[model samples]
Each structure stands twice: as C-alpha cells, then as structure tokens.
Target: MITSEVIWLTGASTGIGRSLAIKLASCGNTVIASARNQQALEQLAAEYNNIIPLAFDVTRQDSIELMQQQLSNYSGHLDRVIVNAGTCEYLDIDTPDWDMMRRVMTVNYFGAINTVAAAIPLLEASPRPHMIAIVSLATLAPFPRAEAYGSSKAAMQYFFDSLRIDLVSKNIDVTVINPGFVKTPLTDKNNFSMPFLMSSEQAAERMVKAIAARPRQFDFPRRLKWLLKVLGFIRALWNKIIAS
Candidate 1:
C-alpha cells in the first residue's frame, strides 16, 4: 500500500482517474483531484474524506495556474503527480474535422505538458518525487481512425521517456503507464471491437499496485501487451486486424 503521500491527480471526475483517487485515498494518501467537472468532483470528495476536489480544465493556462495555487494552499510538496486528463477523437478520411486534430492534441499533449510543468516545483520539494503519466498502448501500433489520439499519446510517451533521463540528476522518478483498452465513458464511444477490455476499477487497481515499484514504464493486462508485441512483427496482419 502506497501511503501517506500527497498525490495530485488530474482528470479525476470519472473513469480511471476517479477510481484511482478513491484507491489512493483509501491507502492513506491525501488526494487532490482535478477535473473540469466541479459537481462530479464534489460528489467524489463527499464519498472520500481524504479526497479534495480541485476542479480545473487542463488545457487552459489560467486553469493550470489556479491549480498550482490551490495545490500550494493544500501542501508544501507533492510526492507524485498523475497526468490522466485526456480526450479522444477519431478521424474520417472521407470528411475530416480538421480542427479536431488541434483539440485532441491540446488536451492530450500540450495540456499534459502544462499540467506537469505546474507541479514540478512542488514535486521537487518531496524526498521521493515521482511523475506518472497515463499514456496509451495505442502508441505501440497504429489503429484505424485513431490518428489524433494515437499521435498525442505517442508524443507523451516520448516526452516523458526523455524527461526520465533528464530528471535523473534530481533523483525524480518517472513512470509512464501504457494501458490497453479500459472500459470508460471515453472508450464507450468506440464503435469498434476492443479486445481484452477491462473495467476502470480493475485498471486502477493494477496501476496502484504496479506504480508502487516505480518502474521506468508499466504496461498492463499482459495479454494485450504481448499481442501488440507479436503484432508489431507482422505489419500486414496487424493492419488487417485493426483496419477490420
């Protein structure tokens, strides 16, 4: 059980983030939960004494600044910052919404980067500073119509991976989580088949346990990871499966 840490979690209104907030708070961590949805966050806080709701949109700089202020008001330092806030929008080649590319990238990529930037100072104050990002296995291989989502996570994967090396001097650990399909409101929008999909609660459970070890990277639901690994070798077959 990871205990007694001050954890700041974004995207905590629902799905994996909400589950994670409850799980961590149950383990004796003080959770500062951030999301655009204030009422949902309040509902979560009502259920958990340790969970403090701090609602803010990650994509907005002003919102991020306000988050930093609220975080400062809560604690002097943060042991970990989890960037789980994200959005997904599939593309249509026949008639694409060109602006969607920007929207998805803003939330998943720049928003994540901005959120992390705001917490770096507080993280540095901790004896064991750790940064965790909820990236996706979508980055491992291509999928039909996931152009924006895949590209954003791909950018996050590389950014955090590179950041791990750079942060070594400060002894800050970075753990990147690459999860396969997890059942959530976000994934519920998918019209295609999602093999080996698991519940958000289950995913959050796995994440909490695995992240305790602070590995350089953690990929879950081993079966999916292996499938992707095998598929990576046969591009034609992989393409056919996803394209179908």
Candidate 2:
C-alpha cells in the first residue's frame, strides 16, 4: 500500500536497485530511478509509466545535487529515498592495494552520504519521510577477502544508525537493510560460495515488505541472520566450522 509515494532510488541500472524500482512502481509509487547508465535506466522506465529515469553517477557530489534539482522540477517532495548505489571489491591481502579499498569506500560509503545530503531537503518536505540504505550482511561477520567491502558496509550501517537517532524527532525514519547474498550483479561476480542466496526479485519483495514495517534494521532470511548472529558471538568456532 505504498500509494502516491514519490520514491527516489539509486543504482537502479541493475541488481537489487533495479528490482526494487520495478517492485515499488508496481506497488503504485512514483519511482525515480538513478544510475550512471542512462540506457539501462531508460529501459527500466519503459516498463512502467510510474518509473522515471534519472541518470547520474553517485560518486560525484555535483551529480547528486543536479539529480536533486531535476527531481525537484518533477516533484515537490520525496516520500522515500533509497540510497542503494554501492560497489563491492574484495581486498587481496597479497597485493594490499589501498586504491581498491578507496574505490569501494568512495562508492559504497561516500556515495550514500552524498545522496542523503542531496535528498534531505526533498525528504523534509514530505509528510512521512523515510530513508533506506541497502547495506550488507558481511558487516555482521568477518569474511575472507572482504576487508574493503565489509568495512564500507559497516561504515554505512553506523552512519544510518546515527542518522536514525538524529532524525527521530524530525519524524524522518531511516532504515538499514542488511541483505545476505542475493542473486545480483554484485554477487554474480563472487567466486566463493554464497549460501542461502536469493533472487533479486525475492530480495526486492522482502525489502518492500520490511520497509512497510519501517523497522530500523531489516535483516532478511531468518535462518541466515540467526546463523550470522551465532557465528558473530564465537568467531573462532565459526571459523573452525567454515574451515572444516
């Protein structure tokens, strides 16, 4: 029942963001999809009249501000802003590339912050403003070669948590979605095992439902969340279990 909501979403070229755009549009919300790939965004917008294509690179602060201005031209307020644009790159300890870490952090952390900054004014104009970020379950536990990716997501988790408290009195809800492996472009590149991997559509559905509840944190797949929680408590034991 997300009727009449003017929703702005980033990273909508593919993966979870694209799936979410479709789902939100189908649910009767006015969805503005943003991504660097204009063709992909246009294709998505073609699928539904409610979907508006907005092309911009989230990593660029000026790009985000321009996007906000464009959005303002179309709609006066944004009920929800989903900063789902993120990049994941595993760190190779052998190579120890600081540039790789910087690349990931710039897109996953700084990109999200920039989007939030740009959208805050539009969100404030809404009667019930909500901000959602698609973080990662990797933050819940340490995983090999995920040094950069995990750390970036962890930073996003903390940022959103702090934002939630600060925006509480303003009646602007902030939610962090910690998804386990989902069958998206991001996970498709992973060579390692991704247990309990769900389809992007399934993930989107879960996100839509969870967002309706307006929970501060939405960790999907109960089994996976429980497993991660238990493993987080005893890292050594979990390492042994995974190793064996």
**TM-score for each predicted model, relative to the true structure:** 0.97, 0.96
Tens-place lDDT per residue, model 2, 148-195, is 998999999999999899988878999899999999887899998888
For model 2, the superposed segments whose C-alpha errors exceed 4 Å read 241-244
Model 2 TM-score (2 dp): 0.96
C-alpha lDDT score of every prediction, in listed order: 0.92, 0.91
Q: Cα miss at 136, model 2 (Å)? A: 1.3
Off by over 4 Å in 1: none
**What is the Cα-based lDDT of residue 191 in candidate 2?**
90
List the lowest-lDDT window of 10 residues for candidate 2: 235-244
Models, CA RMSD each? 1.1, 1.3
